[model samples]
Target: MSATDKKQKQAVIAGAGPAGLTGAYELLKHTDIHPVVFEESGEIGGISRTVRYHGNRMDIGGHRFFSKSQRVTDWWDEIMPLQGAPSLDDKLLHTTDKTFAANGPDPEQCDRVMLVRNRISRIFYLHKFFDYPISLKWQTFANMGLVRTIEAGCGYLWSVFFKKPETSLENFYINRFGKPLYRMFFEDYTEKVWGVHPSKLGADWGAQRVKGLSIFAILKDMLKKSFSKKENIKEVETSLIEQFVYPKLGPGQLWETVADEVRQRGGEVITETPVKEIHVENNRVTSVTVENAQGERREVPCDYLLSSLPLKDLVQSIRGIEVPDEVKRIAGDLPYRDFITVGLLMKRLTIDNQTRIKTFANRIPDTWIYIQERDVRIGRLQVFNNWSPYLVKNYENTVWIGLEYFCTEGDAFWQMDDRAFIDMAVGELAKIGIIDPADVLDSVRIKVKKAYPSYFGSYYELDRVKEFLNGIENLWCIGRNGQHRYNNMDHSMMTAMVAVDHIAAGNTDKSAVWSVNTEEEYHESK
Candidate 1:
């Protein structure tokens, strides 16, 4: 067909998260297809969105922009170029890093720039800091004490000789890190995050989340760092990466920028509008019914549908289709873990700055600290000032931090009022000796629904739901909740990219989209 005679195609995308926005951007860039993205919430990025309170910004869950995929990194560069000049923190500290792009925009003068940041995350157990992934250092052994260290060494050797079958997450950790280390480090934390024992969870979570991380991997990384220069260490595992890039403001800044570019390029991004019903005909999606915040609903006709909605909701939203009893039952029984981040603006923290890394006010240099204290219900803590000096309004005078808690929706923790929850969070921090409740100047609580897709419940039977969803010719599922998989930010974007590649090539098979993060060796190398 001639260019003028060709029929224009429209793609309806649900959710304006990394997956949906990526699908829309790729469609507009690669083809003549018109894309319309609908977001259920008022914000652009889902869990990746930055919440603004007063003059400070909060990254819902801390996102470290480090990816092994060149395609993903290149795409980030296209949206927000890396900083050539020093950022606020770098300029103040008079630091120089090799990751900075030459002849790019300056973060101090320009807002659309990515800053290279040091990654330092440690575990706080028994009122001390231990390297995350359990580094083999003398201080670690000292902190662990003589008896526990001996037990850990013997348990690791035993694990190396006798491997347990990978049937559950508990077994997965025991096989990799040994029983003692797993019990000491992974046991309580995993339970806190998922609200269930590791034995009840599937082993696939370990394979995907912490693929190549183990005692041996940590040892190899230590040896590599000792033998090679910092910048030349390319084979380090993802969990052990020391440096990553981040937006000047936060992760939401990047997504909001992408949303703007989509609009400038003849695409539509409607926020606070959710797809209520998806209409299918002849085994293909034909239209979707969307309802806006004003309670008005309208049908949007489309040639294809790219969905990043929760799989349970997606399966329930289908119309003019006969979902099997098994599929319906499994979808309804799917479980999710909700998250709450309490952003506390404090005058100062009680924790001392013992790390060699210098900060503006000699504060803790950790971007986030994993709380291993069994006494407190708080799971993790994020120091926003360390994430980016630009994130905090008063980086020099005050401290900005986030306390993360994982709980199921409608539970006691989730049902608490904002003020009460914030108070409880502050008290927990004080109890953990990380902060003083009196130092908290202001606080805000942000809750995210379906923040984590659980590996338990009907997750083992997810393949049956996928089989049914894949049967629909014009529907594509992408992103964490959409596929009911706990995918990282890059993996979610890659899923959308793979789906777009298939659509652009006129391929109907959806196998590649579902296989984004499935390979064990690929993740290890990446």
Candidate 2:
């Protein structure tokens, strides 16, 4: 790489997300190429951003900083060092909420960078809590009586003896967890979340989501844990990890620090800039046109482009790029799941005749609970206070909880008023016996469009679109939506890492980025 090459090299990245920001930071570290990041929203993190209201902060979707890949872990540590990470006992565990914030009066005591926390979660179905990994506890057996347990065991044996062809999501779960457990735990909840029956939805989602875990494997692991007192036992599954690392303020703190570091290293991070058009010549992306907050558009020339935008939006923006008709069709047809998080503030939550006693801002032990009951449309709920003490305005009396609903952009839930949505969340919470209506204080609603790149009808057509994009050597799709992948935080960052490596090594192998998280044994979190 000569001076001429360095002078001409400028990588313009679309979307200042984990992937895009990671690519920019890596480019600055490894090469002399000037990288510029453009974010469509006022915030930095995509779905990972922490929404702050008053003095409280909430993770858009609860994120745990645990990755199987060491490279991803190292990358996270580089931005937010966990060497001297804070522990529960380090500095006053049961302290009041008056002691924390990003910019508090006493900054030293309220450092908002690195912290490790415990994780406990379960499925709430039929007003009963079941261990996520389906442990063989006596309480579990009692909840699901002896007869039901025998039925489930028999179903498992039958499935093993006569394996059915796995075609739809229903068959996929049945093959792994058996029919009885699948119907009891997965079937209806999945249908409610995706707005489609398991028999109608594609099995690809199940394949990617629960790749390595099976009923037998979970039982074996639980038995081993229950019997052994060994400290050396490692959690091979992310979902089963007892603890994880996190930013004190929330996940967004890590990315915000990354953005600042990128700027310090002579890189530009422009927020409120939406990509309007991508200009291509001779099958190579030459420039990108983006509109700023005031609706003023400008073109930025590029030697290479890394996009973290949704695949559909990315293709539609390629008007001047002359994309192949087949690729365009596939991109247009790609489906996505939008999300809404209703952040509710409450005085206290009492369940089962016991007030939720607080310890370090946690009212309950579980960080989040999967709502598997058929009655509520809310798929999951997050105990924001458990995630981080800094997330709540007051830890003693006030707590924040996030009721998450998965829906399409134009759907009824999405279009519902904030007041109605809050009321609905309260109604569901009351219906499930999780919280009391009178404890509610105030609420905030955050809607995210295309939050999940859905694995649904015609999702397989994305393979053709990916193939077409790979042919455009200068353009690389390198994130969750960028590749239409349901990648975890680490996997998303890994795609960007691989993409930047390709440019650094002077290779044209875009497949290296596309091949991420495609393994049958690869589950994003689990």
- Give the whole-model CA lDDT for all candidates, comma-separated: 0.89, 0.80
TM per model? 0.96, 0.93
Stretches of model 2 off by over 4 angstroms after superposition: 1-8, 83-109, 226-235, 352-362, 520-526
The true-versus-predicted C-alpha distance at residue 523 of model 2, in Å, is: 6.4
Best by lDDT: 1
Please give the lDDT score at residue 470 for candidate 2.
81
Task: Give the per-residue lDDT digits (tens) of candidate 1, residues 405-451.
Answer: 99999999999999999989998899878898889899999989999
lDDT of 2 by residue, 180-266 (tens): 988888888887677888988777777777766687777767776778756232455545666678887788888988999999999
Q: How far is candidate 1 from the true structure (C-alpha RMSD, Å)?
A: 3.6
165: Cα error in model 2, Å: 1.7
Instruction: Write out the backbone clash pairs for model 2.
Output: none
lDDT of 1: 0.89
User: Model 1: how far is 210 from its true place, Å?
Assistant: 0.8
